[model samples]
Target: MSQIAKTKLTQTQLDAHWMAYTGNRQFKQDPRLIASAEGHYYTDIDGRRIFDGLSGLWTCGLGHSVPSINEAVAKQIKTLDYSPAFQFGHEKSFLLAEKITEFMPAPLNRIFFTGSGSESVDTALKIARAYWRKKGKGTKTKFIGRAKGYHGAGVSGFSVGGIPANRTLYGQGLESYHLPHTQVPGTEFSKGMPEKGKERAEELLNLINMHDASNIAAVIVEPMSGSGGVIVPPVGYLQRLRQICDEHDILLIFDEVITGFGRMGAKTGAEAFGVTPDIITLAKQVTNGAIPMGAVAFKQEIYDTFMETGGADYMLEVPHGYTYSAHPIACAAGLASLEAITQQNLIDRVKEMSPIWEACVHQLKAASPLVTDIRNYGFASGMSIAHIDGEPAKRPFQIAMRMWEKGYYVRYGADTIQLAPPFTTEKSEMDSLINALGDTLKEQH
Candidate 1:
């Protein structure tokens, strides 16, 4: 049992710890705490089983307390518990890197490890700038992102992330511009990749024309936007972006934090969509959420440029990394998670499950008047509700709170309720999830 399970916290004690991205005052007044999790359910402090509808913030897609991951973490802790990441090497890090690269597309084989998705995004941005510098294009420092696209929360991620609320307070940390988001008016309630919004990719060209292609280092976007609602790209959108980037000599970066692993029914969104980026930022299910770990995968040319540009053999090619970069425990967990995913053909399983998920989620559009749109791809989905009065995000927040009371835990942001069930969840469980959501919507009306 964990320490949280053993000890109960008072309202005052909870107040001491400031939470992130939460309404702290309201939470303290009525806290909803989870003591433990197993399979597709979380056991609350009072021993109530709550269905995990959001995959624990779009992380644990393999479910909780996975035996393979638990065993790997336990065994790794018993052996080499910690290692200094800099100036020293560990077998597990190199082995895990190799394992990860095997699943990546050709030429995108080099991996730089980080502690979280934020770090991975920042690292990719740094690599893009550094690679341009090495190629004698030191002025290529600007980055282009799409509106409503979300990278992680690092400084660079924040700059490139196009969510207005996430950026207005922090100020742009990098010289970044945004392309129009692909969620057009006609594409609402799209089942998979919508047919509309393909022209939205041309917005990248407009930015390139406005900013000048030579000034841009890279363009970063989530293949399927996760946090800024589960905004899946249009059918030909990603391919067009790839073509534009190539024509302009601009590097492309895909923030695959949520879509990587089996979430998209493929090893990576690049593979699923048949469009490859120069760099791919990964985290989340990389370790099945068993440990904090992220990685930046680069093409061979990018890796070689850094290696060849350094002044001395002993000098660091890229002067960036976390102390926990490639932590042994994380590597072990990642290896175990990857093994389980591949050996069990979890990606194929997700493909089989996606159609059913699409059908179940789309049905909400007709059942709930509040549902403005429903978007789905692979095993992930988002149901966007009409704003309550003039206040956006209030209705979804209320719905989420009601869901918690009814023994379901989901995620909501900006009038959107997102759901990404674990790959291991059964068809009946999915039916129950949709039914509960439908019932909740009905109650609201």
Candidate 2:
């Protein structure tokens, strides 16, 4: 066990640290502290083993306490713990960039590292605007994102992100418009990519026409909406968006922060859906969630435009980057994690496990009246519950708390209970997870 895991903190100590995206008061009353994790299970403070039904917030695909990743991190700390990312170079950063491009779709070979998903989204947005400026289209600065899509929490991400609750506190973010979410009626309980909602992509055309295509710089979307309830893209939905972007000279950005790195049964959601975007924002599983890191992959033309317009060889072409961009520790973790992903053929494992995952999650629909919708793709699934007395997210919150008591860890957002187990999870573990969920639903009902 790591030294950090061995140190126990009392409730009072925990209270000093305010958690993110958590109900502070309620959590302080009943804090569920995780002690350690191994494989697909987490040991809580009480020493009870809990099934990691959400794969550490859909990030630790290779599971927790991975030896190789730990070793890489240790070696890096001993070797080069810190290095300046700006106006400097690192071997691991370069090598990791090349390794990442191997998984990205063709032409998206340019990599710019950031600190988190939020940074990646903002970076991609800035890159889009900068690229257009270099290409003599300075007025094309507007962005269009889908209503249910979630980019990240950065200022630009919150602006582009379609979750109203996330954006409500922050007054009108970047000058951005939203496409209607693709979760149309009659598509509830979709097993895979549903046939409906393809025409929803045409909303971009309407937005383009309303704003004039020349004023639009980019359209960002998650191939499969993750945080705003795992709303899978309807068949041909992304393709249609790609075509519209192409026709209108708008850059297409895919915020694959949650769906990249084999989450979609392919190297990326683009590969899974057979649609490529001009830019792809990635994070979460890039370093298997072991370190804080995010990256943006851009098309070659975008890089070429910057290079051609850049004043001199030593000039900072893109005057944007985080202080910790491509931190050596993160690069080391990413290298080790990515190597394991490729060597283990984890993407193929996701493909092999997807059907079982689908079957397991779909079974929850009949388990309770609260379950109103079930949407799934690849290894991820989201079960939306019926609203409770006008409290849309209450049922999920209650369900998640109950799930915790029942020795399972799942993510609850809005009105949905999401599941995205590790790629290393076995069918038996999946069965246990479904059974636990079934029992929870039965008790709740």
TM-score for each prediction?
0.97, 0.97
Candidate 1 Cα RMSD (Å): 2.3
lDDT by residue for model 2 (148-201), tens: 788888889889888888999989789999999999998999899998989999
Instruction: State residue 310's C-alpha deviation in candidate 1, in Å.
Output: 1.7
lDDT of 2: 0.91
Instruction: Report how far off residue 162 is in candidate 1 (Å).
Output: 1.1
Name every residue pair that clashes in candidate 2: none
Task: Please give the CA lDDT of all the candidate structures.
Answer: 0.90, 0.91
Superposed model 1: Cα runs more than 4 Å off: 1-7
Q: Which residue runs of candidate 2 sit more than 4 Å off their true CA positions?
A: 1-12
Residues 1-445 of candidate 1: C-alpha lDDT, one tens digit per residue: 5434344776568889899889988877677788899999999887889999988878898899999999999999999999999999899999999988987888899999999999999999998998999999998999998899888777888899988888899864888999999889989887899999999999888898899988999999999999988999899999999999999999999999999988999999999999999999999999989899999999999999988888799999889899999999999999998999999999999999899888888889877898999999999999888887888888899999999988998899887999999998888988888888999999887
**What shift in Å separates residue 218 of candidate 2 from its native position after superposition?**
0.4
**Which window of ten consecutive residues has the lowest lDDT sum in model 1?**
1-10
